[model samples]
Target: MDAIREWLAGHKREVIRFAVLFMFLAVCLFGLGRLISGNTAETDTESLQLDETYLAASSVESDQTPVQPQESGPAQEIIIVDIKGAVKNPGVYQAEADMRVIDIIDLAGGLSETADADTVNLSQRVTDQMVIYIPAVGEAAERPIAVPENNLTEQEIGNEEAGTEKVDINTADAVLLQTLNGIGGKKAALIIAYREENGSFQTIEEIMEVSGIGEKTFEGFKNLITVGAK
Candidate 1:
């Protein structure tokens, strides 16, 4: 037992040296593993931060973007008028404001063969809701006299009482002349023709030179007619 003890005592230092070296290696390995784990955690944290930043930038861009507006439509314009008597077609029609009487007549299929074209003011401008009446050749003879207005002005009423405010024969058209008592379309036209041929009348008696306006007809309208100076 003493011999064996002597042998262990001799080898104790060597064994102790080997144990210290093993402990040092184990400690180095543990420290290296801890360092690797810490580096991995830091990389994961950096990646998460980058993702959060991208999401925040995208949200700001969406908030700053401008929205578009919807578009709208246009409006339409139209007019209406009434045409009657002696036209090829007669009725109410839709028309434009720029249209003239001639344009409206064409839309109404133009005048009938019996229409007295001279009586119509073809060049006149058409208005909304206006009534256009194209008369036949002899229609004026049957037309009832235009009734005098009951709401006449004081001067007009006084003129009516005194048989004054005569229509000037030199300048009056057929329509204006027809307003006089017993003057129809035929007689009115003859008066105009005679005036155009012979120029302006010098006196009230000069109107009798027209074929249809005899002394009897002149006498009837003399108080309501005038020969205005040339």
Candidate 2:
């Protein structure tokens, strides 16, 4: 018994060292497992963050709106006239009631270089269906349209009142005014526009205010045209 006790005391230190080594290995394995678990949790957190970002982007796309265009308004009635002149295109033209003779000239592409307008008046009040006639250069003096008297003819002894050329100021648009001596629809239109914009003219000479009328032309038409409240 005394010999066995002596051997056990000698080997006690070696056995204690082996136990300490085993305990250190167990602690290292547990720390490794904890690190692995923490990595998995971080990966899951990143995956959740990616899913949230995708959902937000999708929501923004789905919530986008569209735009619409606006519509236009209604149209107004415009009075037009026919102009035959030394203009580029001597033909019918459409103009507003208050449109000036200049407007018709513009529509006709303006007068040719040979358009002799030295004595012709251009700015005259006009009406619907008026005709504007512009003479060419070197054209001799114009002949007057004779106002025939209401004399009884062979078939008109007891007939009703004969048709007379009465001028309708309100309805005498440019085209109609063009038919008058020394005036076209443009001048007529100017007259009409002036009368409309500034009220009726107090005197026939007041027609000078139109775009192209001069003293001589106004004097020629002084006794011809009238201005009505209409």
The TM-score values for the models, in the order shown, are 0.31, 0.33
What stretches of model 2 exceed 4 Å from their correct place? 1-65, 75-79, 94-103, 116-230
lDDT of 1 by residue, 67-86 (tens): 77866645434555556667
* Candidate 2 accuracy as lDDT: 0.61
TM-score (C-alpha, index-matched) for candidate 2? 0.33
Tell me the tens digit of each residue's lDDT in model 2 across 1-230: 87877876788887789889999999999999999999999999999999999999999988897556767755645755656557788665666777766677788899888886664556764455555556667775342111111211232221112252334555566665554444654676787787689876665556677788876555444444555554
> What does the lDDT read for residue 15 in candidate 1?
76
Candidate lDDT values, in order: 0.69, 0.61
The reply for model 1, stretches above 4 Å from the true place, is 1-160
Per-structure clash totals for the candidates: 0, 25
Worst 10 contiguous positions by lDDT, candidate 1: 144-153
